[model samples]
Target: MSAMGILSYGLTLCFVLVTFYFLRRTFEEKKPLVFDGYYHPEFKPVADVFRQNLLNGKERGGSFAVFHKGQCVFNMWGGYADNEAVRPWDKSTLTMAFSASKGVAAVIVAKMVDLGYLDYKRPVADYWPEFGQKDKGNITVEMLLSHQAGLPLLDEYLHLRDIVDNPDKVERVLAAQGTVWPAGTDFGYHGVTYGLYVDTLVRKADPKGRDIARFFREEIAGPFELDTFINTPKSEYYRAARLYTQPMWEMLLETLMSTRYFPILGHYILFPDSLLVNVAKAVVEFTKDMSVFNNPDLREVPLTSATVTSTAEGLGKLYGILANGGTAENKVLLNAELVKKLATPLSQGTDSVIKQENSMFGPGTVIMKNPKGQLMFGHSGHGGQVGMADATNKVGFMYITNYISINGLGDDPRYLDLENALYKSLDNHESNIGNQNI
Candidate 1:
């Protein structure tokens, strides 16, 4: 045989062997998935659904936790944190909470308001003078938190470095930017800008001059003994979930073919802030391709609107505090007055920008109104994570997942199923209590 032909045959043999090795690894018998936290008997159906999803390749991995009357009643985690499924998600696993961190940030502010340190009705300019520039002087803290400031999109293009690392430069831009609408007339979801606004406001308003990151560590995370963080520390890198995006082509295909997938992207194009929405979409598209979310530098930097890392248990406990009237173990984190203020709605109906039906807001939290007019408050992240409190019932529940869906607002069925199951459990508990009382 010629020398060239011999080399070609050898290369082919090597390729086959490498392919076989990986195929074997992929099909290897998996260990039985287990959860570390205490599981409630009533939640068995929920757990079974999750287990089936994992087995059927419908889900990757995630965690769920719920608290009732200031105590954790259910905690469970399963599936792989990594896309490869080589590592199982355990008690120590932390995943990005994305927009849900807004709720946590709001809790911190509520604490300040409870202590009479910050006022919601006061103009943000009262605290940060530079923020008053460009006719933003009238924008109150409530307006900004409720996404009514009309500054949702950045006027200028911001590189990833600017968004992730440099807060000072971003502050300068915000100081000079004018609102798209009158300060409180309309509402929009401030996708990336909310964090900068909140952080800047919090830093200046804080008596200690502590930024959100510092304040969260010293006050909220430490005192509450929560595992959540606005900016994840480097030492905890090993525990953080490595994120994976569903293929862009797959998503685009669904948008084109599926009736259910159509409105999500369509709404962004049809909205009043379509230009801003397009620009924001472009920025997210740019980041997704580069694996920017997994960057160590990016993860460590505080982005109160996004980039929070926590276990379901941590978020659940935090919400549990809010559910139980903002007091945990007799330690008052948020007083009764502040709790009332936090529940106050800032908007009357569907948000103009977010297009969410009948959504309301109170500072940083999402106020969900039921048909009967009762309000349930909390926040949901970009993927499938949700942390919420039903204060009337004194219930807190959280669901976190690695499998990210395109529309996180209300489109993901997986999260909706879990939520329904949780509410059903709550109803059962309430009935039992009533029976016992009778």
Candidate 2:
């Protein structure tokens, strides 16, 4: 055959194969979207919203939980934990909450503050002397928590083993690093470095030398009986849900379509040395393979910025305490003054890394408003996972999923829909009570 004919044939064959693959995947038979759980009659709208999403194939295996007044008023779980639909998602199912772990770590820090072990306004150098190097003496604890320390990405690459095996070395590397921006003047998301820095801070601040993981396990999880873990145990590995991510083509399409991400893409292309590019490079260096998160070894490591494993009920109940003035079961987990500090905004502006505008951050938590415009505080993870506390209404909400969304730049619509339904239910319940009182 002629060379031109050969090239034409090769291209035609490749197109045929690609088309066939997409067709087969699109037409594959899917299991029924079956869910099981309990919802208070007053919150039936929340349950209905969940069921509709499952039925519409918008959600895979996941769970949702809400705690009001320190009680589990709504809890639900369903679908398959594995891609093959063999293992069912149940009450014990656990999934990686990604950056949502930061919120959990923030709660731990709040408890530390409440116990008088640490102070937000004090310089972080007070706790760890080495951190004062490179003109970081003025960087306060609140600045780090609020991502205003200007230490988002380190000049040197860091390995997970460096943190787990040689923490002192990691601390020294962080200490020697210079700020990317003028400290306390601007803010950026400390994607990979947040946990490394915070873990070191916890170690130095605690009299017992406990890291954030140990502190959370002993001080928060044990006392609260929550299933959340910064450092997951071996026995609980069996309950972990297998994560599924969108295809690269789908991700690229979504990024191009996203109003928020498109501008960031342009900025990255225009300015190679921009903070956004640096943060992206740092994240990529740490997470070479997104699928590595499913490995037991990664989960066992305490990545407080990510890799937190928990069920919906676990996060809901923990944030429930925060929603109800930091007390649960007649025990004070955090004093009212500390809770107020946590909810108060420490920084507000456009996030240099994510390019999100009008973002507000508290001490290690993202501050947002619910549909009703009531202030809510919590941290969202990489995928669609979220755990938030609505102190004004005393509601704690959590949603976890193994199926990762392609929308990386903004709030996932699935979560927003669920949250809107939850608030609507709350409004209806309150209205009914008010009518009864009248």
Candidate 3:
């Protein structure tokens, strides 16, 4: 063989070895998955599914909690919080729940409604007159909360800093921009813009000019004594789990393989000018690196659409109040009538940006079905975190993880397994109670 040929063969061999090593490292489990927490014996099935996820390497660090009838029935935490497995996930460990923050924001909105600070049917212009520009005069507060105002992605580019620093400028840009679709005719996932718009609305509607973060902190979190935070504080930073995102290559491969996502991916690729493409671009430009969320500085920024940090227990308890007649330990967090209004669907159809069919939006939350097909309302964060309230059964469910998945919204299989087990356990428990009665 020629010298050049030998050199080429050597290089190829080295490349193969490197790729194999990384692949093995990615898949290999370095340690046993150990969990510590409490669960009712009747809900042992739910606990088993959670353990399976950790043992299978599907979850690196996670916390799952289920609140039934305004009390915690199951709470579990396990694995490592950091990428290197240096920090153990514990009862206090908080993970950023991404868009799950939206659900908490929804709760705050409901409280505002309960307090008579805002009305759903009234025009947003009535509260924030500046938002009336660009043919948005008729958009109601409910329309804005339900994402029916058609302002998913703004026309101009915006940085995270821009959003955090310049409130007036951001509000002006949002208000002056025309809807991509006819206002109230269509709906899209607002993503980043949801927080910006909602924050402004909250400030305008609030007599003391409080933003969503402050409003939530002072009103909801404080009153409920929950650890969830739209703006995580420095003292609590130590307990925050570092987020580890799936590699872009892995995400792309999964997207290509998915039956639901492949067509949407193809459409976005084929038409760069499509709403989906624009929304993706806006999000990518804003977030830049998913790992940046691990930074305390970034996590401290108040973004209600995302960047909520909490343990599963904290979120579970908060939603538990909603699930059980909108009260926390006998204290009224939200009126029963207001809670009923929040559970009612306000908009239903195909989501223009995410391309989800039959997507239903309630006041400020997504209306979805639990595994048992019972009506539930909540928001799924980016990656895999979820927090939801099932009013029919008086159940509040939350699963938080630092190991980010490539799945869309709340479609992560690990989460689904736990949710399925939870409902099944509920069914079994109910059946046992019936037998006892007989």
- TM-score of every prediction relative to native: 0.86, 0.91, 0.91
User: What local lDDT score does residue 53 receive in model 3, on the 0 to 100 scale?
Assistant: 79
Between the candidate structures 1 and 2, which one is better when assessed by lDDT?
A: 2
Query: How does residue 199 of candidate 2 score in lDDT?
Result: 81
Candidate 2 deviates by what RMSD? 4.9
lDDT by residue (312-420, candidate 2, tens digit) is: 9999998888999999988889998888887899999888776788988999998888888878898888778889988999999889998887543228878888888
Q: Candidate 1 vs candidate 3: which has greater lDDT?
A: 3
Give the alpha carbon lDDT tens digit for every residue of 241-263 in model 3: 88888866556656655777778
Model 2 TM-score?
A: 0.91
Cα lDDT listed for each candidate: 0.76, 0.84, 0.83
Kindly indicate the candidate among 1 and 2 with the higher TM-score.
2
Q: Model 2, which residues run further than 4 Å from truth? A: 1-26, 280-285, 408-410, 436-438
